[model samples]
Target: VSGNYAYVADYANGLVITDVTDPRNPQEVGHIDTAGHANGVYVSGNHAYIADWLNGLVIVDISDPSSPEKIGHFDTDGGTRGIYVSGDYAYVADTSNGLVIIDVSNPNSPEERGHIDTIYACGVYVSGNYAYIADERNGLVIADVSNPSSPEEVGHIDMGDKAWETFVSEGYAYVADQTNGLVIVDISDSENPEEVGHIDTYSALGVYVSGNYAYVANHVEGLAIIDVSNPSSPGEESYIDTDDLAQGVYVSEGYAYIADQTNGLVIVNVSNPSSPEEVGQIDTGDKACGVYVSGNYAYVADTSNGLVIIDVSNPNSPEERGHIDTIYACGVYVSGNYAYVADLGNGLVIIDVSDPSSPEEIGHFDTDGYAQEVYVSGNYAYIADWLNGLVIVDVSDPRDPKLAGHIDTDGWAHGVYVSGDYAYVADWLNGLVIVDVSDPNNPKLAYDMLWMTFYSVFGM
Candidate 1:
């Protein structure tokens, strides 16, 4: 929040600038649809730095609040969760890549200065000569960033709990420790920061310190206000009660197989699309990211669990048949007897699923960008490779699939579906992008339907 405008990194809508001069009646002034999912935002001077998930850091010119424009971007190796802009550099808490410091002196061309790989850096707070990282399960990690080009970890605290975000103020660091709630630490000594106090709250995910109060954004609970006037012992001043956020669904036969994230794979009788009813469910033990239904079997791209095959011969009682773990399965497409998976960072992975009880990896093709979703057509596979856009691969020879062609879309490609000679891509905020795939080796943008409201498009 700066002056009378509030810059929000709205996940679904991108960067939203609101007129908050009237707190009781805040009004949205303008917004810009970013190429990727906006997870966090930091407004500095005339620009707004956005931590865009897979697309990395996106810099927007907000000098005109009502008409924000994308000025620059720097793609990171890992998912960008939070961003903090200080001086001429932007510090990013890149999930897998850890703390990535980018020289954003030139907003139009930001460059990576350096990075420190930690367990899982999610959020970061840079103050004076130190940077505090909320390293998820790794806890609070303190780094000496007196030199942006080569920041080094000076100290760390392992709570064996998930740290989502951090707020540093007056020599003290407040952490939003998910299940562990809010934890206070003394950062006066950068080399030996110690936990000074803590208070359990319902799923604390964000924290902000103002004067003697600490505001926590909790998942299950609403806004929790803690009185941190005394760093050694904090007390809950007040609390209010909150709400929640589907990956993929495949309709076949008379049922629909849904990769329902934490809920796992859900089988719904969708013979009547208008009035679908839940029929069965099976816990995939991990995030159910995508699903492909073929014949009487259901193939699930169970994120961390990899590819999971379920015997859905009876929609009423689906059971696990066999499974093969891949790098990071997120999307699956079954063609003939092969199960093609869009394995996040690992790209395309083809598995022989001729025998449902014993699946075998047969081939794979490493893509240039993050693989999110895939659609198989004829002897070719069209992949929605995040920032790299629509990547076309020839799977004519299942033993060794090769890249055919690709077209960089206007936005991040998250999902794709092929029909006839055109491939419909769910290009995040850019909406539905239609690609001409008449020739597998030479794909082109047929049309970009940017007005449509779609996240993941599918063709029947």
Candidate 2:
């Protein structure tokens, strides 16, 4: 008996559901056809929402594990890509048209509420009464959405190049400014936002803020840690350089796990920020992209090799615990005893790691596009996709994972992270995106913006 399930939005294949209840025997469950190309999905209560490329938004009912039916949908002026739901509003990344807002008070009928047109909007997030938007070349934008129907832009930060992702904590926002690396901003005063500090991690992509540190997933630089004790003057404290190109990073216990492109899994001891050192490493012989650490084990997305597990009891000497080779693997995260692996082309793979030494493939799910990164919070797994944007999955039952909801931001999404009731994503070329996922199923774009800037003081 396996204990894993998955929901995938298989672009041309529609949305594919699989039962990984057994790692070696993943079986298909259900899928819903869409109007156009599929990009992402989200689930709320018993309904699943999808970002259907040109088709706009598609809603589906998934109360019954065996059957999924289309409920309602709406099309946007721009292409639909990433999405987030909060209260009764759905936020969509409408590509060049910027952020689109919709009303979903009635799951079967959605209505357009408002929209904020800006550069290349990619991801959106809502916190308190403000919304954060990732505006690619334009940088980070803060908007006052107390009036959801008429969102008003309040503050803006121009990050050079493209701002890929953004995460907010306390009073600061952490932004991934593509080639510029990680940028820290003080959003305490949304009207007059200021850049406090930044770490030039080369080509950084994703960012997550934990405690007093900001963890950046640098493409070829691995994981870079910066101290954020002073939101206005954050400084690089230490870094763990993996042998391969790195994409995503997650911190748990006292260690930092990295998804190393060619090196596979890399674990580091961050107990001492100034003296960060690689404690363990494993080569999966594949392009490892994202990673998450839990307890004494680390889970890695071994691109073509699927999911690779490694024991980190002895950080200095890690051993391969188990693996379930699948299609193109991208992102990975662990919750409790199960590990969720994002399979770019295949979808999502769930594995039981109760016995790290002998992991078991339990469930699987397909998505609408190329799965990029995944973040598990509460009972849902938020996925970032290249074409689909953001998809939500229900993991209440590890053995029977199901599509919960979805929203589309018209852009190429690369990574995702959940904080409080909002989910932040890294949108390649576009910028950092913020989405409201408090409702789990229906996500609405709350904010979007570019995450970097360049300035020259004439007097200085």
Candidate 3:
């Protein structure tokens, strides 16, 4: 509420407009529906800009308080959670979508202006039009995305994570700690992420958070669901047993897609998270180690089989749609029709999935070190190059993907997640290492938190 009227973006409901003439009694004056869940709102002279999670931005005209109406909307490829309006643009703290800018000169027709692709943007605060992003492992990052088309980072809060896997959601990061079970950190102070909670779960390999629930892919015990509403005290709400070993997990819609190593891809109905029931299963003919779901398809990193695509549109009955060959495909990231595969032996293998029935390798960049995980943002594809640290490749030219930059980490880089201008590396023995990738051409090491100090000083 910046002026006469107070604008509210409801998470469950839509946008709620209220008349706050008098502080004691704020009465609802007008309202409108927004796609997905409305997570954050910003008020301009007479317009209410809403940051609709997954659905993107929705502009509502409130010039006539009693009759607020939607004027325009722009869909974002990544998840949007927070927003801020300044001058003639709106800055959005979009997860994976990074920082998105919208030109709102015409209140009735807001259009996409510019964006900075990031893998883990916590939250965004704006002053003088410049956006301040709370970036997890990288800390606080100051960016001038005012010129939408060419956004750049001016400053950053550097720190580091022997973090196994990392996931960013609504200003917080959940990590599967092999040594600590589960670790939750608050990235609101982008420059200062503090450990907010932890839980023990024997041994954890991967983790995913949906709503208030954090799903832990336990190596030997299966899957563990934790209630994270109270970040300071995360409580285990339930646990479900799975076949073989659960190495990775991806939650989408109402199902938990698990990369059940050796056993292959396993699907469980999580609509009722506590009691997860196996609804579907796909034996990829190889060890399933990584999984990612998009639309109605499930792309799997079948260790020996290379890339295996499955049709999970029918959750209870998943069928193999296609398969492509690559060398030790361990991690994957799909964007549009291209599937970027982290081939340990061959390097970055780009497969054109325009036809899911037959994915073809269009291009590849043979990289150094053991490629573990990958995250694609904009034209760049980031790889956690084992001992090589962070490897940034220019993928703008899909078929001609080339190495744009590379940064060596302190430890063996096992996993990597990018948000905006920084890359959070899960450096196995070194812990979590944060690198500034704003200047992709010259990736510089910001800082790293070494849990195993002995390994930090000595080569492992």
Instruction: Per model, state how many residue pairs clash.
Output: 0, 74, 12
Worst 10 residues of 1 by lDDT: 240-249
Best by TM-score: 3
Of models 1 and 2, which has the larger lDDT? 1
**Model 1 steric clash pairs:** none
* lDDT (10s digit) by residue, model 3, range 69-132: 8888878877788887888888888887688888888866777788886667656766553576
Instruction: Tell me the TM-score of each prediction against the true structure.
Output: 0.51, 0.60, 0.63
lDDT of 1 by residue, 322-441 (tens): 999887887888999999999986789999999989999999898967798788989999998876789999999999898899998855687776766777676653445667789978
Candidate 3 stretches with Cα past 4 Å from truth are 1-163, 452-460
| Per-residue error (Å), model 2, residue 270 | 2.9
User: Is 1 or 3 the stronger prediction by TM-score?
Assistant: 3
RMSD to the hidden true structure, all candidates: 22.0, 10.6, 23.1
Q: What TM-score number comes out for model 2?
A: 0.60
Candidates arranged by TM-score, highest first = 3, 2, 1
